[model samples]
Target: MTANNELFILSASHTREKLKQLRRTHQFFCPQCKEELQLRIGEIVVPHFAHKKDSNCPQLFSDGESKEHLIGKQQLYCFFENKGLTVQLEPFIKNLSQRPDLLVTTKNEQYAIEFQCSNIPIEVVQARTKGYLNASIVPIWLLKTPNFKQQKPTRIQLVQISPFRQQFITRHPQHGSTLLTYNPTTAKFIYFSHLLFIHGYRFIAKVQQLPIAHQYFPFLHLKEPTKEEFTHYWRFHLHIRQRFLRQRFYLSRKGVQDLLLKGCYGARMRLDQLPLFIGLPVRNAQYIDVYIAEWQATLLFFLQDCQISILQVDDEVIAIFILNNPDYFQDERGKDAILHYILLLKKLGVRSIHSSTKEAIILQLLHSEFLAKCYEN
Candidate 1:
């Protein structure tokens, strides 16, 4: 049997009992293609409509809906509907020729909620987002929560946010960058907020789980990481950074060509001896594709070659560096990451016209407690 749960084009939604009674006499059609739809209410799956065997609709039924997707869609529909909000399930927008899983409308905004389950290309995501934006509809993409290891609610642990998952990271005004995901099995909304990247795809983040009953339309605003929580995060970050340094020495095959290694070689410094401030966390560091150490270390090397001391570096100089090395910095915000690293250095009082004198400041910053030095305003 087809797993597709393409809904019928109807003015109002109905209960299973009502739908079953109507299925006996009334006929339903696809909203977009105007094709006949079959109502499938089985013991195993949630009640939904599907296209016939021979029907080849261009939209709605193209991608087969998974059990999780169907259940989650229905759950979200009820979740919003019960809140007395205007919500449409599998509504086809005529102008854009796009059918979002759920189109939610509030007093100020209309949002197209895409409950994505399967892996799709980034181009498809961009295209859909562009279409929604052009039609003046905000697109909120939610992913099915992956099977992650259960951790204690109080503990801070390292979680893997793969490259694909990174695309869904959205920036909120009050909170920092966050990714929202839903789990159908438990009816929970798992939020990974204030994500601080430690290494490639590995991040030390603040996670919160709320039952569907407690979840709000505009997600509940999370507070900033407390000082105690940040202390734990820094300790975990140091652990991961040490591991990354070790991996580069023994596991990595790239010798001279590697950016970090090349910088260390040029500076005549060992991996362990490298400055502590080089890999420290920066806002928008996620925009750059490489690790924090790789870009920051290379920036130092570039500064040395150009005879431009770290004390003299400014936004224009960093922008020029980003332009010169396009391969390393893919996004425009990458320049911001580099500048923020410099800002951190300035915060730590790293000032010297002489390149040789930087070691003293570096050593001081390295020996100081991370929380005291970095967290201080």
Candidate 2:
């Protein structure tokens, strides 16, 4: 008989009445709830079992149920063992410690294969692979057929492998075949026979092959940080610094100014210092020196967002001051000034006041004093 016909016969023959007869001969428990089970097959759908009314039964399985999954796992184990591969079968790794369906090991390699019959969340699979990689073990995820169909095994299209350097295999449900490849390399999926004898079989099976056009580091596909994200990052940094060192000063605006100066004076400085400032628009360089000259004005404006309290002066609330411009302070000194300013604000409830020239000179003069104050009781 055809595969579909065979499935129909198997499903139809195991009707509620037939299951009832079997249960009468041998009592059975609900796979989900572990309560006493009663056969309750539908005339149209496949046969199923229900539990007693008081049972706390959840939906066991959507496709073939637990019994079917057990059978499938057993059959798969047999198939692999028959091929001379040492298969560690069913609940491999033990005690819910991220056990895979099968753990295969040879003289030179080891692999963890997850047989996913139902469609599970991709991220869950990815996380599992990540955990496996941390343990120095490689993972191969396999999606099995829901029921034994006569059609070809689903085409296993490899997804991603963990450690970004391992092998992975994925069997597409519809096509009934597996795609196998490794990580950190742009290798194509060859026939299963071709892969069986390859070195690092375990690691090579879990990773997806990159296309020829893609470069090694593909973070270019990641979304650009939004303005709001940049703001949050700056706030987070401020909070972290405050918690660790007891200081309060807005780093975000300063960071922007630093970036602006770097872009404006790129030719005069080394590229290593470029990242000292980030998030400034490349085109804003021309106006940067002008903005730096008006540091106090910018600080007054940004103070509102920083949530620092200010005394009202000339119809404006102003509390803090910007001591130096990006050109005045080297990167290390700028960092030191920022930390010192935060500690001073936290302790004295007063902000530092400085002209642009004093701001420029204070770093060299106050470096030792600031460090002493920071460490003093």
Candidate 3:
């Protein structure tokens, strides 16, 4: 909450500068609870209203706002104001009992914009979003931009998407899936879209940054990647996939039965000899909470256990695997990842489905020139 800039009511809002000068002559009260508020002015911190030590406000409470949050909210409010949109800072809604950082109104719809700069539980985000949606108001959550040492926004980059960050991921009709972040110091907005989930906590995202002054209300969507760009992405994906497998083998304890390595040994296959289709990217694979290769290998091992081929794979097999290995999946829908992976396997195995031996299939399917080049280096 940007306490410095919240309104006396929905109609009357005060700036920090106004609050600073008015502190000597006037008193302020919370907009929601109507309790007397102490105007806190400081040299380092921004001028804002604070509840006295003993005061209690049921509608809202001070969470000790950070300077970054205060400034960011203020800037966003002004940015929306400059666009001639009806915007309110920290409007306390009666029905939802939620104080959105900025309540924006357009001709036909309302939106609750939360400029989240601090780490909060995902449950809080979910509840707030649910509240807004239940009230027929859309929720837009923008996080603080992370510090990227040498970020190249033009191309795909490996970014750490922590659990907290994952809560902000949203889908736009035009943008597909996107996460928006703002940098107050630079006055720029970073858009992360077309997320390609690599593994745990890491993603290959298409990143772009726009100056706040040039930004528009209905944010611009990142264009889909071209064939050349996708080729480069797959090359990078292959590189990271190999690197991840090597790290797993190297990092596993000597005495521990490593799932991936053990599966490979049991199948009489080397890491390099594994099918190219095993670790290929699948939609929603990230929700499985396991390495793409590891889980995909598990699917193959399961098929061997059932004495079946890819064509024989069905809902029963998938259900049984999911039931037995519940830890790999993060949610119920995570089972879809296995199904999607099987679909991809079936597509790849169209030519090799009738092959007699697993070794023969592996040898026969090494025909993708692109994949061959990717794995060779």
Candidate 4:
């Protein structure tokens, strides 16, 4: 990661300043390794710092900060600085033994904003996140613009999504949770939230953007999905499911994927006949790869207009009957397969209520599509 120069350099006081004098007199040092640095204030390129010679410092050993990275970082500094907020560039914490790119303090909170221009290990991210947490500082990571890819008008898939990146997902008021990214060049914040998990490393989010200087949202506040918006997203997802049902070869054969394929085909089931309750959204659905169709089909044949013993119809029975593999689930592995839908069914007058009903459940497959139309109206 060899770059000829950098936008700013650190001094003994850890201050970043522009070139004012014709000839340099201040002794600037490398921020990463504490080695002495050389300054180049040329006309063609912006003023920057370079290593002495043939240095191999871990921090400096990156793909070298690009022009976008440098300008983006400086602009981020300006973002807080313009608001008359007290901000520091590369503030070093002795106790934590870490230096964040920018640190700011409000009336009651301290924030460490890291403008991550390059990819780094999730462990490093977690370690730094933990350090900031231990020091009572909130760490906000703003990914570069290139990382957020817009696949379609309504679909924005975040690039390089690992388990660690998934941790960065936070709740937006209307949307359940969102992955946020900032475009330093445009001076705008992009909100990629309201995700519908398709597969591993693949999700489509409702895309919305706002300028950084927005009066109401000085801080990030992505728009929450409205009733109309949520329905539109759900309907689009249904279309996707329709396409998948037509040709299921795109999916990898692993875990319960084959089970879903075999069970649906074996049942001679039509996707149109599937109940809305079958694919009820769950918060932790991302943890398991089982599609909504897989587990939902397990409950289809079991439902009748009769009161049944709840204990006998557990996750194991469902897994065995549908998947032909009872050993797949243990410790209530797929207990949630129908929990929410069952609860909603009762709520929606699809089941008769009984006082002190604990051991038995009365289930009847109400025409869910017709009910969905009624609900939609």
Could you give candidate 4's per-residue lDDT for residues 1-377 as a string of tens digits? 11323424322223334454522545656656776666655554444566767877545521246656666666677767777777777767878888787888777788998877667888899999999999999998877655434334553332345665665776544435667777777877777665655545655566777787772313655454555565555565556556655455445355345655444555565544454444544434444455555444445434331233333455555455445434434334345535544555555444321213221221112223212321110
Model 3, span 173-268: residue lDDT tens: 444567889998788999877676777787777778889999998766778655566656666677887887777766778533666677677777
Which residues of candidate 3, in runs, are more than 4 Å off? 1-27, 33-38, 60-63, 149-154, 254-256, 304-307, 320-332, 350-377
How far out, in Å, is residue 27 in model 1? 4.9
The predictions' CA RMSDs to the true structure, in order, are 5.9, 19.8, 6.2, 8.3
Worst 10 residues of 3 by lDDT: 368-377
Model 1: residue 278 alpha-carbon error in angstroms: 2.4
Which stretches of candidate 4 lie above 4 Å from their native place? Answer: 1-27, 30-35, 40-47, 54-63, 147-164, 172-175, 215-218, 249-268, 271-273, 299-338, 348-377
- Answer with 1 or 2, whichever has the higher lDDT: 1
**Candidate 1's residue-wise lDDT over 348-369, tens digit each?**
7654212233534543443343
| Per-candidate local distance difference test | 0.75, 0.37, 0.72, 0.55
> Whose TM-score is higher: candidate 3's or candidate 4's?
3
For candidate 2, give the lDDT of residue 16: 69
Q: TM-scores of the models, in the given order?
A: 0.78, 0.27, 0.80, 0.70
How many residue pairs clash in each candidate at the backbone level? 0, 22, 0, 1
State the number of backbone clashes in model 1: 0
Q: Which clashing pairs does model 1 show?
A: none
Per-residue C-alpha lDDT of model 2 across residues 88-202, encoded as one tens digit per residue: 6533343335667667776766777665545656678778888778776667664432221332332221122232212233333232123432221112122221111111121
Q: Report the number of the highest-TM-score candidate.
A: 3
The lDDT leader among the candidates is: 1
